[model samples]
Target: MTRPSNDSLNAAWDLIDHSQLILVVMHTNPDGDALGSGIALTLGLRQQGKEAHLVCPQPTPLIYEFLNPGDIVEPEAPAGVPDLAVVVDCDRADRVGALQGLVNQARRVLVVDHHPPTSDFGDVRLSHDGYAATAEVVHYLLAHRSVPVTGRMAEALMTGLITDTGGFRFSNTRPETLEMAASLARAGASVADISRRVYDSRTLAGLKLLARALASLQSSPAGTVAWARLSADDFAETGAAPEDTEGFVNVVHSLRGADVAALLREEQPGVVRISLRSRGAAVVSQAAEALGGGGHALAAACVLEASLDDAEERLLQELRKWTAF
Candidate 1:
């Protein structure tokens, strides 16, 4: 990943300066980074008297309900075409899901993300490669534009920072990332509160789902690779929503001597979603891309319209290419 070019950065602000009504959107799953960056940017734009609205096709995950990403992320797209639409977190516009229709009608589109830019989606891209999270890039852009950071904005940005960095425990967490987090804390984001809700909080349904996932865990012959599966039945039986499966992959990754891990869930009757994690020689993003998905090097995801066994096999095959031992 590379940093945003000065030309693209200038074009992004120029597009904003020339527009009035702006539509903000994130990827379909609406993770902490998506919700936080979208909310913070929406709030900041509104503070400057722009008619900015952040909307998503999917509801905010239960774990991120504290940020109230749903408060402004209505399902209804704006009736008319927006002067500019900003896509956050995701590199491609298609990842916006049902909201793609709304983005298609916008006069201009700007992307704010940290993913490896694989597609030409936005008219002006502020995608940076080195940041720990998209929220970090958003913060840098906001400061570059001289926007005043509000308490609410700070809170949302912190959510993105903490969650994506795993509370600053991941390899991507740098000194500068911590400094930005401190700045956000000074603006009002509570580290303890965000951590408690995101990492510590658990629902009965989620716990039940975790048990089923653990029961289904499997490993490769070498024991360096691990995976888990949950069918639609498991989710329905446990009364667990899709978002409840969020961190379950980490449990698989924690398996002793595992270099790579995956969690596959049947999102629908034939549609399976897989999340990948790696901490060794594997770069899961390549596997994700081959499976028609994309993400960071350590974390990536993909979707497959196949049976649980088939999807599991596909992912295992991908992992086998990297984790031979």
Candidate 2:
């Protein structure tokens, strides 16, 4: 695995040493990479006798409740202003949602992420898109600092690695990723248990939601683009929260002729969440960036402030502009 630069690693450690109270914030929706990095950092800092608090804009997804990191709190600012804020797995500060205010209160901001930065907000930005997951970067940082990776920390980091790589099946997975997984396993991370809880176990309601989403699947005329929609009604009927629809977008990529896939979810009345995926050289991040969202080349997302139908039409227009087929 490529190592983090010594300058960046030393600078981050210096900031941590000079700070007493630290705030760690993840993105609004709080995916596995986001949670894994934030929680692991929180635990690591606290282990060093520093006061570290983890903030998530939304509640932890039911599937990830196995993490049970007690330090996670709502977006509200803590008792005292934090000396340092660590933003993980988020490309932009605004992605922290309401917690941006709390982060702004910190004296210094350190951004450790794997996505391309949309803006220069953090005081110290340690971003490397080459890494498969932000947790890998975090693991590197901790290892360099000589922080012992506890069993819990290993599990959390492994969760981020597995989830971000689609269980090591995505194109981003590399030899280094597997190497990290093997090290984490040796440190007592249960690959089987974490995989089962994250990918295998699903609530009955989630399954119903998945069925409804699949039922709405559609393809473009040339069959190069496949898409699906999940309406607010579907969520209400199935009694599934938005988090339960995590991997539903991958279903579109299963189609034989599909080079691009999208999943549009209408979680609120005038708001649509768009998740895009592409194969080979097709770049879905470009489409997401056009819509004021960003992610990796193959997987990206955006939010549209329109009705589901209008969002669908707009996204289709955008996808057609880049899709080869």
Residue-level lDDT tens digits of model 2 in 34-60? 888888888999988899988775678
Instruction: Point out the worst 10-residue segment of candidate 2 by lDDT.
Output: 69-78
Best model per lDDT: 2
lDDT of 1 by residue, 156-181 (tens): 99999998988888888878789999
lDDT for model 2, please. 0.88
Which candidate number maximizes TM-score? 2
Clashing pairs in 2: none
RMSD values for the candidates in order, in angstroms, are 1.8, 1.6
The 0-to-1 C-alpha lDDT of every candidate, in the order given, reads 0.87, 0.88
Off by over 4 Å in 2: 71-75
